[model samples]
Target: MGRRSLSGKVVVITGGARGIGAATARALASRGAVVVIGDLDVEPAKETAAAVGGSGHALDVTDHAAFSAFLGSLGQIDVLINNAGIMPLAAVTEEPPETTARQLEINLHAVIHGTRAAVGIMRRQGSGHIVNVASAAGKFGFPNGSTYCATKFGVVGFSEAVRAELRGSGIEVSCVMPGMVRTELISGLSEIGFLRPVTAEAVALGIVRALEKPRFDVFVPRRLNALTRFQRLVPRRLSEWAMRVVGADTALFHGASSAARAAYETRVHG
Candidate 1:
């Protein structure tokens, strides 16, 4: 299919202050999309938006009323990217209840709320796209990241069901599953063989491609899609062995105590 033009499209991105969200905002703007950034960090979000000739707003995605108001303020919504999330690594048993709740609220519930709001607007217009940023951990569980993995897994499943629901409504839904990305989210984490960390720009490009082509599943580095498919068909024991070989089993566990991750961990924990 021919690529769709992003020119003049009004795209709304949550968590656009940094990382993949900021990268995507710049990329879509380069394609002539009028990007609107919404982040908890209003100052940085505005800075990013100013650089791209877009606009920024204070958005707390976890609050339904605030999220709805933020979207409603936008005149037209061509695309909505639910990108706000936090990852606080810890063993499932050792994880605090507050930490688990925070992850669920930010990572999964917020996506759900934003998607539903976008659907209402898109249904009225009869055209739109929703991109949910999940993770490769959503496809396979890893040590010391059980809650984080659960939230991502929920995003993957939720996106699939919503995609099916919106099949003929002219509103496309994409689930982005990226491997360990070179962002603060993966600070202090070591690369696991060939599953090395991908750049935030690379993930942003995958999102851009999804917008242009309207694909349902978007995997950064692209190879992860195939690997995940293979993992699904293999025996459980074999898949477990493969994970061990690639160091996925202990990457997050070791990263938890790394001094490099202290600041990011502190921010997320608070």
Candidate 2:
């Protein structure tokens, strides 16, 4: 495949009403890509789209047919950013089963549905890019984010397989692993000494870079890839001790305040 410019390309971004998704929409739109924002928050999506001189629509990623229909309405697409995800932090035993299930449905299953909807169109066009946003937890597990980690790990693995399967077909797949972006998902959480969250704008740049370079995986901050690979080489006991030393072991629990938990519960149940 040849290197392509984003200018004038039609790009669709899921969950584009806020955070990294919204940032990506703004960045890509500025680069001349025709951006389309989709989210359950229809009004905000429209507002975001209007701000970027794009368009917005309501989309429930869990519904497979809705995903396909939205993609079909676009006619032709140059890129699809599977950016819709939710992170509700809780200890495995203390968390509600329904909440965990909902997290998986949104973070993992929705990405799958979005990819399935876009892959066919891209394959037929013989040119496109698919960017899936995974997290640092996707590469390594933490105490309070088991379910979120599971979903992201699934995304990493899924991206690898799909990239290989689509090799030489002109459709490229990129997995973006970002560490602690300052997004709404972690909003209201107390700032920790060790964890410095980057801006959503930074991660958005990483996504755009991945699309231009067509790499299988792009880690925001770049150094995160080193940490992710190093974790795998060390023994489990040492890794656990390292996590404790860095205060990652308790970061999620301490950060997930009662209000945050309640907010998630209200969103999922109501």
Candidate 3:
């Protein structure tokens, strides 16, 4: 199939205020698409919209009413990008119920809710694209990040099911599994010592590529895809051991906070 052109397409993106979401909005708008951006932060949303010459609205992806209203306002959504998420560090038992719930709400349920809302509109139009931003963690579980992994894995699974369900419907669903991308999410990791990163622009570039090709899944660098696959095949015990040896805290996915640092200090000093 010939690649689809983004020209004149109507795209809606969550987390569009900054990071990958903002970059994606610009990327699509640059291709002449009309973009409707939704973000919890109105200031950044306005800035991104101004830069891209598109529309921006304040929204929390977890709120069903807010999401519906955002979509209702657009009336037509050609591309839907579910890009809002948060990672808070916690051991399984250490995580507050609220933290896990919020993560599930934003990272997982938002995708479910967005897919439902967008599909209804797209099915009516008979043409659209849905891009759900997942991560390498989605493919292989990380210790201390079990909840985060579960949510991202749910994204991959949900995208697959709907993609197959929507086959030949003039609508396509693509899951973008990005590795480390330089974004504000990093601020959540100040206590962490290691840094491996990719720029939001680069991740955005990969997303645009995915949009054109409409692939089932997109992994930035492409090579990382193989590494994730290999990781998935490794025994859980061995993988966990290797992760500890390298000081690769799976908790990194949940993210670090001053509070978390204080807790760690208490544990160490006590």
Best candidate, TM-score: 1
* C-alpha root-mean-square deviation, each candidate: 0.9, 1.7, 4.8
TM-score of each: 0.98, 0.94, 0.87
Tell me the lDDT of candidate 2. 0.85
Better of 1 and 2 by lDDT: 1
Span of ten consecutive residues with least summed lDDT in model 2:
261-270
lDDT of 1 by residue, 180-201 (tens): 8999998887776867889999
Name the better of 2 and 3 by TM-score. 2
Candidate 1 ranges with C-alpha deviation above 4 Å = none
lDDT for 97 in candidate 2 is 89
User: Model 3 over residues 211-238: C-alpha lDDT tens digits?
Assistant: 8887877887576677667567899787
Off by over 4 Å in 3: 188-195, 232-270
Question: Per-residue lDDT tens digits of candidate 2, residues 29-127?
Answer: 888889998898899999999999999999988888988999999989999999988887778887798878887888888888888889999988988
TM-score for candidate 1 = 0.98
> Once superposed on the true structure, which residue ranges of model 2 sit more than 4 Å away at CA?
1-3, 258-261, 268-270
- Return the lDDT, model 1, position 251: 70
